[model samples]
Target: MTSQTTEATPDGGQLRVSTLELFFDLVFVFTITQLTHVFVHHPGWDAVAQIALMFGVIWWMYSGYAWLTNEVAPTSSGRRGLLTLGMFGFFVLALAIPDAFHGSGVAFGLGFVLVTCVHTALFASSGGSSAITAIKHIAPFNVLSAGLVLVGGFLHGWPQYLCWALALACQIGSPYLIDTSGFEVRPRHFAERHGLVIIVAIGESIVSIGVGLTGRDLTVGLVANVAVGLALAYVLWWAYFGIDDERGEHALSAVPPRERSRPALFAYGYSLYPMLIGVTLAAAGIQMSIAHGNERASLAAATALSAGVALYFVGQWAFRLTLRLPRPWTRLVAAAVVCLTIPIGVAWVAWAQLALLVAIAYAAVIIDDVITLRTGHHSSYV
Candidate 1:
């Protein structure tokens, strides 16, 4: 029961991401907004850990769908229904985030269970034999991790963390637990899908600036500070979109399928998880920073502001390394430099700290461009 329509683009060699896929992503970004607010409402160590644990589990399935649909697009009515159900699951998770560690844990877990189930069924039904085989090996791990999340929801303290930790461990180990060499990855759709996700996350960050703007008088300084925040978002957007995404796609496409699992998984899955976290953290930071542009930062705001940008570069460093792109010294240096600004953020005004961080980000982009020119691999593998 596939759709009468083909998933292929008019050009025929690649698949265009469907409108339904884009609609599904709207829910995913909503989850990002909710996760961002978890920190906004409660800025502390607990909030940070909860975000880490929750994101790890949530992303496993989110990225899993990207992989699923790369091979099996929801061109069919049946697949679309299943995907829409999965989207509802994500919306439930989004609604649960503020209270995930409190009263809403069960609902969060239930949503996760639903997401996992739909993902497995959707992938299992529509894939070719090899993909089905891959999903067969992968499905049990997914089920077990979802179970842990549900069990963790039942508990209330350190015990809950342990269950979720175990769930995260299972997800991390699943790729190694089985042979994933049989997994299919078409470079164009895969890269485009991920690129769209990344952009959505960045867009959410910009949305946070607006959230921060609420209730503030429209002043010149406030408007200027907001402008700088947008600049930071733009530079981050350009860094990924300018050359690296294309490079990533080109790198994966250059490799045969048997060799793609590692690079593809790292580029989109493992590496982007932390990168997305970084963006979320930065968004929260921007929200807080914009509210007090003239005042020195609080500990949470300082850490989020400095470390968020640093974490993004660290993830980018890993992404480039996994793709066997140039050594990514630029990203490494940018990461280190941004981290050093936490204390400065605490000591100086929020605008000052943000300006400094954006400067470092802009510098990294210039260096990356220079690297691309020297290697002549700006858009190619080699």
Candidate 2:
């Protein structure tokens, strides 16, 4: 069955998201590459501060545009045009990020601040007081970051580093300034949007695995490694989209706008942390495997994949609890995710054994779900 609802806005009510909105997701393909590059290059303690700060800023900008699109789009062409421009800004920003904290800090910071201007235009064109509020909250940080970028232009060494650090702080804190109270989110629409992005992340993982395996000797070990990587991706999808998503939609839909926003932020925005982190880790693992399975699996790769699997279950449990869903089957899914991590852990003893074990464990989860449905035990949790 299909479901639809009209969101009542200060502006005329309109359909939530349309073909254009879905198509805009292509912009993030560039974004995903930028983020993946950051982790790949540095993947260390020093990088963590910058990575976390940058990730949050990227989410804030993307979510801000998305929220505006949910409200102002279809009703206004100007809004759509501004969003298209904003996507361009994002493209520029992605290109400039590699040198943002270093010598090219000016170009990187300017690219990002320009994005803020696009966001400001988008929200202002939407014609609500919150537009002004969002602008006020975000612009200072943008300006501040811009100033640091200017200073870093001439400075070197620690002087440049200090400015970037200050800029990072401002970027990370911008969302809280905008505040989530009273922002409207149509639940199914929001869930579906983020769900599509998750699929993109997973699809990228598959592509990364394929890229890793290509033009190499087709050995049994390489074949098995591919199978295991694909299995892990499937399990991650099943755990989130399969069960938790519907529950989250129902829960968010039931709440008053004020009460609903935090969970929405946590469930949707924060959930990407695990999903993207997992994809990055999986990519690293594939790279390691392709390098002739020579070195021991790094702690970082294992942690990334494991954390991704663990977060899916955590997200599931959180989804159920938020909605007061008490289904036994949901609990079983959570248990199965915990068990799935064991194979990833087994990599320490033997990498090939780890791959095979991961496949079995993931298959076990799918088989259990199938059996549950077969016996008439499948129950709606929301």
Candidate 3:
């Protein structure tokens, strides 16, 4: 936190994501894995709500650190050590995801509190008066929210959820409550950090496919399902990175300094909620479908797989809107088509349903590519 502002500022040219930062991200790989596990085992609406709340807290911790790193260079050994310590907190939080609703809620709550405390300390020491001011406003809310999470851990059922919800409300609303004008965001670093996290989430989806298939007897049907799963994951990757990735960075970079926070909040901060949720849901779907390959899908499984892809498309559209870029109709149509397939998918075998989901995503990417080629523009709506 110690005002390494001079070293951290992008005035030294475009700031790049550091190796330590990438190292820190490895913790979230486990976090997402646990989330997919939770969803696959407990796909009920109540479970989904709990997962979403947990994800909100986890996302805040991750994104908060990203923002912190963007402002403060972890160049010194001391700073790097602090980040590593924070990583341990996240790792512990990931471990608590399974029992977060029941057995080990206290551990989960305390882990989150620890991470947020580190974030507040970093912000408190990093910038000048503005950073200190932000710390003053945000730190108290952080403590209060952490206390709520801890208190929620001791409660059960609806009351527990209520406390957790109140805690998340404070974290989510804090950005607007505090004055961000004093802080500086290096657009390149911020954009790249978020994009990399998305990539990690995608990797988790890929891992889910493998994890689901582990130790199963390999057959032509299972093999086919695996291929389709990989294709779906690839299409998700291509859909986002093909057009939006670099453009997103440029969009953030182009925003006026004084006004940059709004777009950053919209494009990266807020939009990422759906993106991460979609990716997690998609991973859960892949696990369910792959595990039940050759069997007919349940409504829940079909909807999870289909709705996951649809949600991803919706998220991409929102991201483009945030950037003030044109939304591709192909993606919107793809979302609709995927949703329509829930019924079709329910009647079809799991592998076939997966194949259909893959087709929808692949078709969208292909159509977007064709439109880009024909019009010399990345988005058809442009």
Candidate 4:
């Protein structure tokens, strides 16, 4: 269940992600884009529910590959070639996402099923009969889920929803079908891989904001907005990688396999909750700035932006709390919730607006960090 080998730290070994990993990640970028677009088009609680379901699907695919790559990558040229082939299916599935539930669910389902099969084969080919047998336990379930997706794609309304619902259930439960304890997953490597991917997601958010900034005509307010936005991004980066990531890395480094696995799943793997929300809120904030003033603000938009900021901090809190690291992160959560209240309060206050709310919320995060530092409460600090 454990291995003597330890992966090199980011500095000790190459920090560069491999070409194949980048190519594989490209598909996920496309998938996130599709989910964003689809969610935007619908824009309500129902759409949020559907997007949540789709996100589960996305998370499972990525999680399976991550574990597989951690175990078997660099072991064989043959496996690497098949990985490239699997990435192709992922690309197709991503491209089919916007239409997955809309126009061509069949195309999406088939592509997804194909990707799952490819991954299943790769895992089965891992080491011996145990690996094959372990993977096979989950493979049939994947096939059944894929069939549901295909059938769901063909139907309309509730029937389609039902198919996807069942499919998602199967997908989420698939991990339980195997004695995952036997997998030779080095916790440090797995955690580090996911932590890097999250950075990639956050980088995309910065890129999105940068792109928006470039196209707009600059005003005094616009300049201030840009500064605040940049500051906010930096704080988010600090919140994740600053000390939290180190603790996660250390936890994985110190713990036995069974205990170490939880951080990867609950802490790193669930990061989409924050990453997605932060990006969406930050994007909406950019558009709000570009739109002359807060004239376009709606309760829905305000709530979305507020929820996004809140979730990112909550995720940070959860990441720390789950690992029982240097800090409890309770103050961080309190600050985040207090900051998030700005948007709701703005709805009632004449002077309060989205831009101002963002500025205040972001400032609070910095203040909270400063206080934490001054108090020297973090275990990592000592």
Candidate 5:
């Protein structure tokens, strides 16, 4: 199950992302877009939970394939074909997101099962007996989780949600429940894959602004709001990429082989979930505010915008912690500022409040940059 073959050599030759991998990532762009639509149309606690649950399922399944590719290069014709099939599976899953909690649940469930089964088969077909043994430990939970998802498709109300939640739990918890010590992750590939997905999530936010303005005639006010939304998105991007993009990969590469899986799971697998969630919520908020421009913002819309910013900071804190890097004090303070401003900004127009939120984020980035300069700790990655 352990893969000495996947580790980097002493010279630190970085593994490049392959063409097939980029093609595969296109499907996730649509998946994240669809998830944002779920929140755009349905704005309530129930919808939030459903979106979060479904997002977790999609993220988990996608990350599994990412880890698989880290070990097995997708250069062969057969491997490319398998990955192409996975793309179709994910496309169907994305299409079914609108009705995942309703009539098309069966489609979503079947899609989930299809993708998971393909991944398991790929691992089973790997070269080593250890790979096969790893499959033995991993496949049963996948099968059971798939079954639960399928069964959940047939139910309704909270009963259906309960079933889906349990399925997600089983799928997410399985790696920890079983011994995956024999498994290996290529640090660069793993980090790059996750980072690419984060970019996809941010792209979804930008798409939301367009979708929100679908048929409306562009006005000065609307154009101004769109510009502000773009600024917020840019700040989020800088917040992540401005720091060492490869810090996590470098940190993971430094870990002793036997101990890498835990940090990989906790940091990339778990901590990144909230980051994705934050982007989705922000998309929802941006869409809502744009659609309601020049009007009083609802509590829900304000909360989504503020909470989304806070969650991003919180997620960044966890991710930086995992890399054993310095704490992101600016992000933490920014998150607190957003939360505290929410109640007081309730009376402000939605667009104005959004502008203020952007200001807060920019301030944090400026402060962090100043601190890095003072300490001479600033660094960049290509």
Candidate 6:
């Protein structure tokens, strides 16, 4: 499974992500927007289930591209073209997301099939012998997953959920089906690229706040809501970028290239879905709360505001575990405490619950920082 191609990056030092890949992320931005919309429309346990199911499939492919590009850089015109084709498929998938479980399942299925095809074709055609061999072992599972999604499009209710769940299972289990010891990870590029995607995905939170401002007069309550929402967003950003982002890169770089896939899988590939889903839910909740600043939040809005932050902490904890980082007990405690405030959002003013979420998040960060400093856990120099 190891790539014998021995390709060097353009800089011959670090293989930085290319402009075309950044351009491809515009499609990713749209995908996140569509996902957020799904949550905003149906803010509850059902939204959680739908987002987990749909995004599980979507993020799997997105992660596949991240790994694909990590190995097969889009340095040539042909590679760039294939990457663009994949972007188109992603756009189609996003377009279908709003109604995917209703009348648009087939559209999403078609897009999923196209994305799978392009990923398989690009990996087989452009990758090194190691990559080709890896794809050979991996592509059937991908095609079968795509077929399951297409089949799910024609089914309904529990059957549809079952089929799509199987598709997602197929993806999540792909790495273990064969030895990923043959896979390659350009550590810096892989880490930085996934970091870029998460940053942009979370940026949607700020956008959601602005969207909340539409058609409303400038008022102090609205101002406070926006400020607290932004503070929560900053808290989330600092939680990742402040320490864990660099730690993730360090963990990957510290490992042997062949063994890098394990941390990369658990840390980046698996953990990203919950983190991004939290962003989507939090963003929608912010929009709703800010839009109705004077009223008590709905059950859905309250859950999104509280559970979204909880999920982020949980996801970050999982990520730290995979990287074998220091204790994240504060994250779990913070998550539990935040969930207690959902009833507050349901009964009190939205801004009160919103501010409480920010407070809990900041406290978690400070506590984690103090514990890290006291325990002399300063390992990663980044």
- lDDT scores of the candidates, listed in order: 0.86, 0.59, 0.80, 0.62, 0.79, 0.83
For candidate 5, lDDT tens digit of each residue in 1-382?
1232334333222265666777788998888888877877888788789888887877887887877776667645786688788889899889999889979899988998899888887777752465567768988988888888889888889988998899889978898788876667668777877888888888888998998899999989889999999998988888887764556778889998668877888788887888888888888888887877688777777788788888888888788787786655656778888776566346868887888889988888777767766877665632
Better of 5 and 6 by TM-score: 6
What's the candidate order when arranged by decreasing lDDT? 1, 6, 3, 5, 4, 2
Candidate 6 colliding pairs: 1-182, 2-182
Off by over 4 Å in 3: 1-14, 328-330, 378-382
C-alpha root-mean-square deviation, candidate 3:
3.6
- Candidate 3 global TM-score: 0.93
Q: TM-score-based ranking, best first?
A: 1, 6, 3, 5, 4, 2
Q: List the RMSD of every prediction in angstroms.
A: 3.1, 5.0, 3.6, 5.0, 3.9, 3.7
Candidate 6 per-residue C-alpha lDDT over 135-155 given as tens digits, one digit per residue, 9 for 90 to 100 = 899899999999999999888
Name the 10 consecutive residues with the lowest summed lDDT in model 1. Answer: 1-10
**Model 6 CA deviation exceeding 4 Å by range:** 1-14, 374-382
Which residue runs does candidate 2 get wrong by more than 4 Å?
1-16, 41-43, 47-49, 74-76, 129-179, 290-295, 311-382
Best by lDDT: 1
The residue pairs in collision within model 1 are none
Report the Cα lDDT for candidate 1.
0.86
Q: For residues 1-382, what per-residue lDDT tens digits would candidate 2 score against the true structure?
A: 1124334455542345566666667776666666555655766545444555455556656765656655465445766677777777777767766655656656655666677777766665554565456556666776676566556645656676677667656665655776655455667667767777777767766766766566788888777667667776777677566655665677678878657666776667655654555555455444434434434555554444454455445545555554555453554465455545445444543355346435554664566567656766443531
lDDT of 5 at 220: 90
lDDT of 4: 0.62
Candidate 4, poorest ten consecutive residues by summed lDDT: 7-16
lDDT tens digits by residue: candidate 4, 1-382? 1233433333222122345665677777666666655554556676666666666665677777876676555335787688888788777777877666678777777777777887888887764455466567777887888788778778767788888889888876666555555454465566666766666656655554555566577778666555655655666666666666666777766767555544565666565455555555544443333333424445554555556566676777767776776455653655456455445534553124444555655565556557667876453532
For model 1, residues 1-382, the per-residue Cα lDDT tens digits are: 1233447643222265767778889998898999899998999889889999998999999999888887787766898899999999999988988998898999989999999999999778878778789999989999999999999998888999999999999999999989897677888888888989999999988999999999889899999898899999998888888788888888899998788977899889999988899999999999887878899999798899778888888899889999987767778888898888788778878888888888888887877787678875555421
